[model samples]
Target: MRAELVVIGAGPAGLAASLAAAARGTRVVLVDAATETGGQFYRQPAAGLRAGRPEALHHRWRTWERLRDGLAASSVRVLTDHHVWCVERTSVGFTVHALLGPEQEEPAEVHARAVLLATGGYEHVLPFPGWTLPGVVTAGGAQAMLKGALAVPGRRAVVAGTGPLLLPVATGLAAAGVEVVALVESTGPGRLARRGRALAGKLPEGAGYAARLLRHRVPVLARHTVVRAHGDDRLTGVTVAALDTDGRVRPGTERQLPCDTLAVGHGMLPHTDLAEGLGCGLDGLAVAVDAEQRTDVPGVWAAGESTGIGGAALALAEGHIAGCSAAAHLRGTAPGPAPAALKARTRLRRSAAALDAAYAPPAHWPEQVTDDTVVCRCEAVTAGAVRDALGLGAGDERTVKLLTRAGMGWCQGRMCQAAVAGLTGCPPTPSRRPLARPVPLGVLARQHTQEELS
Candidate 1:
């Protein structure tokens, strides 16, 4: 089907964008890989699960309800379970290719004059020993299980990570009746306090999470990290160690935290595969966007975590702004006198920037990896191999790829990009490619035939 605007990812960003554009008299189609509208932030119970008070697990329930209502009321065609694989520019506008089904074997496409990518970020996991065990999951993944499936990770859990998300996940697990043994944060209290001014202005509710953790009596181990996870078939315990100022594990400071589940996450990186495939310019790990949230490429825009790893609030603001901008451009209207939507976008952008700087990952984090620690789970690449490549003078990410083949797997480096970059001693680089995901040869042949016929 063709639409005036196609918003990829039905999360807060896409939902807000579609509703805003549809309200501005634009035909919109919102597509998502999941079965529901909310992205990771507002994940809901499955259709069959008759859980009362699903909002009890969520933070901003009212805002989500408003967006949900707007989507239902607007002239937006919502397509769930649409895993977009490739997007190509056409003579008229753009063509989005997707695979739709539980198995992702069915083909689907959406033609639109403009496209807004709201593809969200994924958890950045640095693997330790026994991470491959059954019970070790990312911090976000644990939240997804609890919020979406209404299931806890285990009876006892250890939440280890360096981010604001640790607090909620720890407290939530505790609230779910799981005994949270420890909340291990690698970033020191001094660093957190240093960023306090910026963080405070961005998220005033930050203190609320702290209060909740204190009330729950969860042990907050600052300046500590999970050095190794211990288990046979499932997580039995994890070796948590104090870190020096440089993020190196202090010898003889290791203490084992007994838990059945180890919920660990470093942070998040923006999902820019689709955007990078389209040759969109990137600012560090994020897609570079203009004031209007428009990419350098015409007829293409991006919002939410695809642009950067901000929380849902920033995403909502960016989506609203992008929708209005795209709608205005489509109608050939002058972009003047910022509307309420534009003002909100401005506010959100400021807030997102502050938070981004505040919660930035600790420098020298790669030093935490021991020689035995696995860096890439897909290829089973270890820290020693990466370090060897670096010692051999692998100057860039591409050279590191040649030396170690760290990014050649099916995930295409989504699982290992951050670690590889840190080990290679360089900034993260943008990955450019022709297709976002592996395409079926038959689909490509058919598309070419149709083009020739036309």
Candidate 2:
């Protein structure tokens, strides 16, 4: 496949970017790993499900409808189920290496003159005792199940986390007829109140979720954290504890809540694997972009959660700006102003920053992790192993990985890096891997032969 521009995601940002660029005369190809266009935020049910009211699963249904209908009517090519593993810089521009469909073995490629990365983000779930139980899932994973499959994780659920995501997940599960036992948030109300000025725009949306929670009669437990999950084979319950002003668990405030499901997530982190592979600069953990969302690398741009962990609105604004800039650059013309998008970007960014500040996980959370708790699920490495590695002079995550094999698993540290960093008292650092995902050796060998022949 070939195109003047390739947008690597079908989420809100990629959808908006592709439409914007196509409208400006750019031949764009929008690629995604999923079978559908909407990313996690606007995840849709499968066609086979024949959902009677898919829009009911989402809040911004009208916005999603517009994006979906716009793509269907646009000239841009849409390629779903293409799992991109690597992107190589070619003499002309770039070659996107991908695996076809769910099998993800057959190799495919898309050649493009320019690339936009809207790769999105993933949930950051800190490890707790019994978290590896079958019924314990990340808050996003639970939401994805309801949104994508029209299924609930369990009938009785405890949505425990310190982020804005918990509200929707709790209410959605409750509305789906699940008994939401409680919404346990580690962050206190005082923190959010302190950021009132910055989060003013989010008041209405928060209020709406609050109303839903109230309607569902779901108890809200603020300034609380899930200390541990309890189960023999699957999640049966969880121990909740109150947190002090300093983000430490208060003694004598621990209580056990009986629930079949524990949906927990501290927050999210940007998906920068592809950007790091492309040698793009990073502002801390996320991809670095200029005001127009263009990366430092020529012919490459990034928006949405790949650039930062903002919400859908910020991603849309950044995507529009990026698309307009990329189109103008390709057409050898000055970019036209996008005043409305620019304004939204500024305001939404402020709200995102405020949310980030207010919803931080408890500072002393690691203290609650039992020594035997498994931090790295893929390798089954325990917290004790990581602590032992620290005793062996492993001062950082890389050294801990080398000693304890904590991050040398299938995910290559994506899931366990934050946990390992917390256990080691080190900041999580950027990991640069040549391939964005695990590729079959056979596929690599075949690609090598083809490149040599070329």
Candidate 3:
């Protein structure tokens, strides 16, 4: 496929960017790895499930429908089930390499004059004693299972986390008829009260979830953290404790909650693999973009969680601006002013900044992590091993990885990067990988021979 613009995601940002550009007569190719359009935020149940009320799972159903319907009317070409592995700069523009289908062995390529990366972020997994168990999953993972598959992670569940995400996940699970044992939050309500001004716009949404939780009779335990998950083959319960003002777990506050599932998450990190591969500068693990959402690399733009972890509203605003700028650039013209979206972007960004300040993980979370607790699931490295590695003058994550193989696993440190940095007391840095995802050896051989250039 060849296009004037290539949008590398199907989420709110990608959808908005593609529509905005194509509306201006620019041909765009919107590709995604998922079988459907919406990314995690707007995840819909699988079509085969025959969900009676798919929109019930989402908040902005009209917006998603508008984006979906707009694509059919625009010059945007949509490609599903295409996983982009690598992108190479060509003399004219660039070539995007992708693997097609469920097997991900067939090669597919798209040539584009300009590329927009709306690649979303992933949940930050904080490891606990029994996190590797079957019934233990990330907060987003549990939501995905419910939204995408229309299935609950478990009948009895404990939604434990520090971020604002726990509010929705708990309410959603309860709404789905799951028995929510408790919502354990690490941050105290006082901090949220102090930041009341910034949370004004979110009041209605938060109130709605609060109403749902109350209706479901779910207990909201503030200033609480999950010290450990308890289970043998699967999650049967979790140990919850109260955090002091300094974030240390208060002694004698520990209690056991019986539940079949533990859905916990601290927060999210931007997905910047391709951004780092293309030499884009990062602002604290997120892709750095200018006022127009243009990256340091020419002919490339990034929005959404790749730039920051704001909600769909911010992503849409950024995507609209980026699309308008890219459209004008491709046409040898300057971008027209977009006052509304700019204002929206500014407001949403302020809200996002406040969220970052308000929902930070517990200060003494590392103190609760025991020596025997597993930090790196793939390498099976324990906290004791990481502490020992740190004691051996392994000051950085790379040095620790070299000493303990903590990040040299299949995920290449995506799952354990935050935990390793937290445990090592070092800032997390992005790793540069040439390919965004793993590729089969056969695909490489065929590409080298240029025999399957289709």
Candidate 4:
């Protein structure tokens, strides 16, 4: 398929971008791995589920509906179940390669004058013992399950994490009839209070969550962390403890919370594998983009969580700005003023920055991991293994991976990137590779033949 723009996610960012560009007379292709377009944030029940009220679990439901309607009303070609694996620049534009089914044997390609990456992020999980057991899921995973599958993680659960996401996840689970034992936040309340000015702006919404927690009589444990999960096959309980100022567990702060499930998370990281593979410069964990959301590479742009781990609102604002900028660039027209959009982007950016600073992980978090703590759940690599690798003078993530096989798994390094980086005492470096996701050999051969013929 040929178009003026190809957007690689169906979330709020990609949906907004495709709509904006299409409205400006640009033929756009909005592709996603999901069978639906809401992404993780606005995940809905599958069409076959016949859910009674899908909007109840979601915040900003009207905005999502508006975007969905706009997408339906526009000329954008929406391709679901299309998992983009690679993107290559062409003389005229760019070629995007995707695997288009469950088996992923089918090959699909899009030719576009420009590409926008709204590929959203995944949850950052710091694993402990028994985390691999059933009923132990990330905070976002639990939310996704509730939002998309219309199922609860378990009958009783504890939401433990170090970010603003814990509030919504716990409240959503509680409201969905799941008994939430507690909301354990690793970051102390004092830190939140210290960021007074930033917290002030987001008060009403925060107050709403507080009120919900109070009404539900859910215990909120600030400055506490889940030291370990206890279970045989599934989660039976969790050991929680209050952390000292240095984030180490206080000797006498240990307590056990009886819960069938543990919904835990550290935070989120940018999903920049595709952008990095395309040789785009990164600003820390995010794809480095100009004010217009153009990456260092020509004909390639990125917005949303691929640029940074901002929430849906910021992603939408960035997507709108990126769409307008990309359309203008493709049309050879000087960029015109989008004053309202620019202001919205500015406000959202400020909010995202504040959230980032406030939810910054504890400095001494790594000290909490004992030798038995599983850091890389995929490979069953424990903290001791990583520490052993570090003790042997492993200099970087690559060396650590080679020595301990910490990141060699189905997820690559997505789940263990932060842990490995911290363990190795190396700067968080970007991973650049040829393909974003694994593709069948036959599909690769076909794409190669097609490329040669073209």
Choose the strongest candidate by lDDT.
2
Give the candidates in order of TM-score, highest first. 2, 3, 4, 1
In terms of lDDT, model 1 sits at 0.83
For 1-454, candidate 3 gives per-residue lDDT tens digits of: 8999999999999998998899888999999999998888888888999999988888889998898888887888999999999888888988889999999999999999999999999899787777787899999999999999999999999999878889879998998999999999888878878888987888898899889899999999999989888877888899999989988888999999999999999988898988887788999889999999999999999999999999888999999999999999999999899899899999899888888888888876788788998888888889899999999999898999999999787788898888989988988888777788889999999898884565
The lDDT values for all models are 0.83, 0.93, 0.90, 0.86
TM-score of each prediction: 0.94, 0.99, 0.98, 0.97
Off by over 4 Å in 1: 202-204, 335-348, 360-362, 391-393
User: For residues 1-454, could you state the per-residue lDDT of candidate 1 as single tens digits?
Assistant: 9998999998888988888788889899999999998999999999789889898898989999999987887889999999899888889999899988787777799999999999989888766667778889999999999999999989989999777677779988988889988999877767656655555654457677778778878888988888778887788999988888866778999988889999988888888888887788998889999988999999899998899877888888888888888888888884444477676666666666654554544466666667777777778788899889888988888888888888877787888888788877778777765666666788778878988998
Model with the higher lDDT, candidate 1 or 2:
2
Off by over 4 Å in 3: 451-454
Preferred candidate (TM-score higher): 1 or 2 = 2
Cα error, residue 443 of model 4, in Å, equals: 1.6
Best-to-worst order by lDDT is 2, 3, 4, 1
RMSD of each: 2.1, 0.6, 1.5, 1.4
Instruction: Report the lDDT of model 4 for residue 137.
Output: 89
